[model samples]
Target: MIQLKHVLVLVFLCVFSGISQSTNGYELWMPYSNIEDSSLTKKYRDYSKSIYFPGSTETLMIAKNELHTGLRKMLGLASIPTNSNRLENTMIIGTKENLNSDIQQSLSKAYVEIGNEGFIIKTVSIKSKTVLVVTANTDIGILYGVYRLLNLMQQHKNLHNINAVDTPKIKLRMLNHWDNLDRTVERGYAGFSLWNWQKLPEFIDQRYIDYARANASVGINAVSLTNVNANALILTPMYLEKVEALARVFRPYGIKIYLTARFSAPIEIGNLETADPLDPKVQQWWVHKADEIYKLIPDFGGFLVKANSEGQPGPQNYGRNHVDGANMLAKALLPHKGNVIWRAFVYSEHDADDRAKQAYSEFVPYDGKFMENVLVQTKNGAIDFQPREPFHPMFGAMPKTPLMMEFQITQEYLGFSTHLVFLPKLFEEVLDADTFRKEENSTVAKVIDGSLHNQKLTGMAGVANIGTDLNWTGHPFAQANWYGFGRLAWDPYLSSETIADEWLRMTFSNDESFLEPMTRMLIKSRETVVNYMNPLGLHHIFDTGHHYGPGPWVSELSRPEWNPTYYHKADSQGIGFDRTPSGSNATEQYAKPLQELWNDPQTIPEEYLLWFHHLPWDYKLKNGATLWDGIALKYQQGVDEVAGMITTWSIMKPFVSKEQHEEVTMLLEIQLKEAKWWRDACLLYFQTFSKKDVPDGVSKPLYSLEYYKSLKFPFAPGIRPQWD
Candidate 1:
């Protein structure tokens, strides 16, 4: 029906407009794209035509700005006037204290259940007129509620009859940035750290503001800006000024900045003779340092300390235990109402009985010894962020102490940013793991949320994956892991399915065609990586140093725990680590039922067969295949799954942008290549031990095992710097 010149002009406009609005995944899950569904768009426009916000506080202002911005982008509406006529369909937002008396009274019942940072969003009738109200106890909660409303709109959810009451289960939902002073993040696959120390005090990067907004949207209240393997200079006046500048930027977004406290700061920066927890001079120095930090940033969240682990100096260096070190920092921070998150990830070459058993042994003994302001941070797995690991035994063991979970959002073990591994599935597996500490349903979620142990000061920390990359996280889908971590940290009970569904809708589209297949792919991704890289509970087999690729034969590390050979234990007889009573007795660490179940290879789940028992290659699995055949099949299955993902994505091109589709397609191809590399490299190397040919139906390796081993990646991103 259109003329030729009109068609040409339309094409020109569309092309130029698309160039201006092109997405490189920078918006993450908060992309407020204009709604294509006219019916839904009309409903949203009607609901948000006017606003009645009653506060002028910083957080309230942020919430107001966000509401205006999101609505303008999504509904194509200009800034809606605040405190406009509330006669019909007005969106009301404010803290309970600031709201009208009648509205505050109406929300009083719902307010009781939600704690300090909780919010209530409901469609209410006011004097015979319908209005949507977002009310909370504090300004920050109002901000959260506003973000929630935006999220719902982004996902194209119905605004009518909306009654949502939400609160964060964990008190301290935090991101532990392993970013160093030099802007090189440890185990960070993305580009350089978000913190630009060289230009900080004066030049405030807009990225910092956006970072705060992103974190605040997901209820992440705290951020430790430095690596746990800390540098003492961060505590000095020179860096404290920089950190203070950041804290000011994040404060309005309800994000409190934390610093990783170098345990030997008293000696390293203060020139003290000894960094002993018992020494008065060292204690005084820390107290003074705490005072100095609090003076600059009044609401500082406190310290995250990695002590006596991986060669980091600690109170252990001065004949003191974890309690001694943690209590000292806790005491120093107590005056400022700050908390200490002391890490429980410890292992020493000297205590080589079982590396997995060391953390529980070290911290469990000092259960009630830690100060009230201290929380012991433990990794999700006994080992370090393996693709698949049984929930750490320490979860149930430390009843008297608040054991905060430390999940790695960064894929340090599962192929970094390149691989599309959805970590929420892994996080869900650990959270839902039955600790059996009390009765049935005593989950790790319960342990960390303080319901199981009846302890206070609960928290969960995720090692941040963010960098200065244009997309924030290097890969587009890797942003899901960061989003998932924040969601889980808020409520550990949230299923991965729900998270994937939400993320896909917000980050991409609400179209069912895109959502269904993409959600399935994301949910299955972690298992795919596990199957290919560490089938049947085999773990820590990645190449030495960078851990970028397969290295099941590595045994050259000085520490036994650091060697891949120490974990797999592959030989002519079989492959696996025997951790039962007959071996290292690591099974004894778990609760009764798990101990009994894991002690026997026959009863243990086949996925963890290699972790708990050293089985023969010819051992029959539940699938009626030999262990060797099962391993090979799993590897092939993983590769096939990746292939399937590529196929799935190819068809999704119409649902997403050309750039997005192309980027993911490229990444999926890389995943397939790496999947094959893993399948071939590990199987080939293990074949030498089993002296077996490639199993039936499994693809043959293109190269020899020696050739796979000869490949090198000296400049792999995220390789731990030498100082660590």
Candidate 2:
């Protein structure tokens, strides 16, 4: 962390400049600006005067070029190729296959060994002069090594003893971009889609380059570029050329592109009568589609499908199972070494039963029937991304199927782009959840990553929050969510607080004046949002359609599971949804311990109290407060915490970019106002059922429950129409 005085100096620079600017945060974690530390800058300047990549391979060239771009911006020098005369004190980057005779001799001397996605950076005496070697096992490893070196420079780490070696713990670290072809994101809050398909094959956006750079920096190797609610047109020849263009740009960064496949593409694009998986014509159509995709981009990462769910077409329309649908695509892509990622977020309006049990019921019986290349990507929770939810029942139940964990970094169900909610905590809470697969350490993380279940080809995906905004994500602080998602995807065991601290130091300054309170605010931010909006496991209470504000009274939606009132069973005598045996029996979906744990309200954690049971409004909580009072206090506390975040940010005005700081300042104010809006609207609405007072010191609502209910947001972003 940085000292207080250094932080003050940054504040002075911003204040004296008198520049008040607004930035839509589109740059994301790749803010490759100049370095601040003089000593480290000098060290890098001395060490990287020139650089070399040993191979002529395309991936190696990309690694070398990216190093040039990042180092040039950081050191204010145009990087050049190494000259034999300048070989000493220069950075040498290569794979073992392409190293020079002398460098190869040194590498064999046991000073360095490379892992698959790993590299070794070592200082050595060459011809009685100092030289640094960044050697790896493969071209992909060399690219990753470049990113690690850039990160070390960003954090101002010492290069003298920089012998760091690492590889991704998870095999498939990926991002699932919910970007539509028309530039409208599904749950995206950053800006419009970055693809810009209308101009894509003609005009490649520079943002795509930076996007690849950012993803590579975090060890993300795969990207799916369309919304899961896929369009059949994306499979057309025109879009294939656009996708191939993106793949060309990202290939150098070691990222393979993937596209969401519409299940009925054979019917829509191939002019086939039916897309039945069992039909020979439909199967031949898929094989032809796969062949076409490989022709344009041989290294394409295959398809992500959301068939038979949320009205998307799937084989279920023909009375086929998920395994039939998924295996058909897997067989098509298998010849190209590609895999299919089939989403398990299935729900039916026809089945008006408990939403939490629907996915497990649909997926569990078909576990061992899936093809080896098929991955059943399940959301962290059974319901949509709620503020807090227990581990999805499918985590441990599908031992025979490879289950990929999917998390929402876009905050669709949280508060959109306005609230300051750090999502790493939410991620950690889910990863640490135990599935009781014959041992205590059988965490959901292990299950998803194939450690506990011993399945091969593990995968995890983050729903991307990227857009066309200048700052990447709209909220400046929200950049941390993107950063955290990458870090955790690489190694799921990392604590949320640890990721936050690292992001704070790299993105802001290393000063304690900035890090201390700021870290505290980030660590508690997720819980604060939960307290205000969906405390005690009360889920999906946001407004209908766009889901912008409080909507505990929303009960008139078309489907039973579409309304907030469906999740939170708040009535005259009690509050909370009863998912226990007495209610929906959702607890029976888990293992014995979890079943016991969630079935009994007393043993269950207060964080998930309402998620599992319904209790009287006057029932005494574990904290010696009644259920109604406890819920009310949490709401008020969330409001206060957001206010505190604003004050904390105000105090660290010196250590941030003037443009960035002012943007965050305004966002925090927006958060504060909305936090109060959530607290007031929720308390006023829930009170109608509980008939409880606002507790002694809590302020009364500024507006009536009727007025809050009258609120509407027709213009809010991310709400798809029934037909869109």
Candidate 3:
């Protein structure tokens, strides 16, 4: 949010003097480069003449060290620690209790407002000296405040009269890593797993510490290290030792470690025949396991169990319900103040209901039945993470239960890491969606932050895309997805535009020329992806197995919902799933207003037209295009949008490092090529049923429908069967 004139100066300094050392994105966003604005540099230097950080705890010391590093790099000053206690031109960093009595009394109301994990970074006038203060209620908050203060400095914000006090709306902002022990990641576009299991416990990689730094910078307080497709061996003593090592590294950054508990671990590792929730031995084993984990790592977060879903073992194996399973674990962790995050991403081959409605039907009746420590984690959409989807119906339905949102930070369904899709745009849209739970404007953010439901526990979990790649995430811009996820998890209501602006300023360039167009491009990237891949509410049309390309014709999987044809019921007569009263009636799961609005195909948004109802091939769209033509045009528009991105990037090449520009240019080329692949492949396949041409505005198919159908990838990055 820097003014235009200052922005121009920053850009000029960056372009001419090479102030931005954006060589490879290995630094993530904490580059700590010299300030691009000369005026701001002097002002920051004046404030950083000396620091008064008065604490010996690890978190506090980390904040003190960060100040040294930031000041040294950005302002070219040592700003070494001094015990003189001279208030003049000093940067004070401490908890509220550690601050001077006079200042503490004046800031008591601010301290109370920020709660435990919030912090204040302000320039205060005390005893005729201009001193900047960074104070919080807890050590972790001090660390967070220091990170925030550095970030503002990184973005070249004027801190002269700054008064910023912020807190996380959600309690547990976390990254759920789907990483395995063997070094493969599920749905991971990034090269390989970050955890080197063979070298752990003894060999502590610097990457782990940097990962914690990155997460802590954005206010992510918790992490689940293992895949939800759980492995019981991870809970064993050997792996627990490894987990303990990771826990130690993350501890200083205020991140609690969570492991996925395989539902049948009692049988798999505990030498018990059954993992039945009601059984005495099974319950005892889990209690003992929790105790053992806590003994190793005192602040260990509880399990993230993905049970009774996707072939994973659960309480249903023993004819027990989810409550019985969740409560048993909850009881074990309750004494330790740990939480059991039970994923509600369940669908069954046994149930004869729509896949989208099954989670709601199964979990809604059991609302308020779960133990206090148990949190039901639900995905953003009812279905798997598609490019675009209507908000899941379960967010408002399970009112009595504490529901945490689950969003995919990886690009599993959106052309992988190759496409520069800014996912915060997608996250923002979902957060702003009104559920009409209690009344109008009851947004998904309210439900997640406990403003609407007044729930005790609230969280937002993002499936991590991190790996051993040099840039952290595979594509450089993919870093923004991880960055945006944390920012949104910290404050769900923050706009994607604001996130794009901040990320650009910190990671790439703060200049107005570079920031303005890129911000717009980043904000539009997700929709561009949506338009190309799954335009007009098409869901899960990914091909069989790898899902690397278009697969709308895919069918004949053993499970009915596993096939793309199941989602998009394209036929000679019509297309789209029938979720209205006459069909699945999934709309009935939503609130009354939504149900009313969604029942009719004509009234629903065209983007979601196919999701709620089946429509005729010739149904007239609002733009006067037929249904088939509209779909074709949207696919074409998506391709054109990516082309526009290329053009925009090409123009801004002078603003970025040559290596970065070239790397992204190559990736965007792949994205455009694939966009055409999606456009042509799907359109050609759907045209068989539509019995019409692709329409005037839409581009012609580059390849035949048969060619697209015949293509197969045997070794996509995140594939199935072996999964490794």
Per-model lDDT: 0.89, 0.84, 0.90
lDDT score at residue 10, model 3, on the 0-100 scale: 65
Using TM-score as the measure, what is the rank order of every candidate, best first?
A: 1, 3, 2
Candidate 2 vs candidate 3: the TM-score winner is: 3
lDDT of 3 by residue, 492-535 (tens): 99999999999988887788999999999999999999999998
Off by over 4 Å in 3: 1-16, 78-83, 722-724
lDDT by residue (tens digit), candidate 2, 31-63? 455765677778888887776666667877777
The alpha-carbon deviation from the true structure for residue 451 of candidate 3, after best TM-score superposition, in angstroms, is 1.1
TM per candidate comes to 0.97, 0.93, 0.97
Could you tell me which 10 consecutive residues in candidate 2 have the lowest summed lDDT? 15-24
Pairs of residues at least 3 apart in sequence or in different chains that clash in candidate 3? none
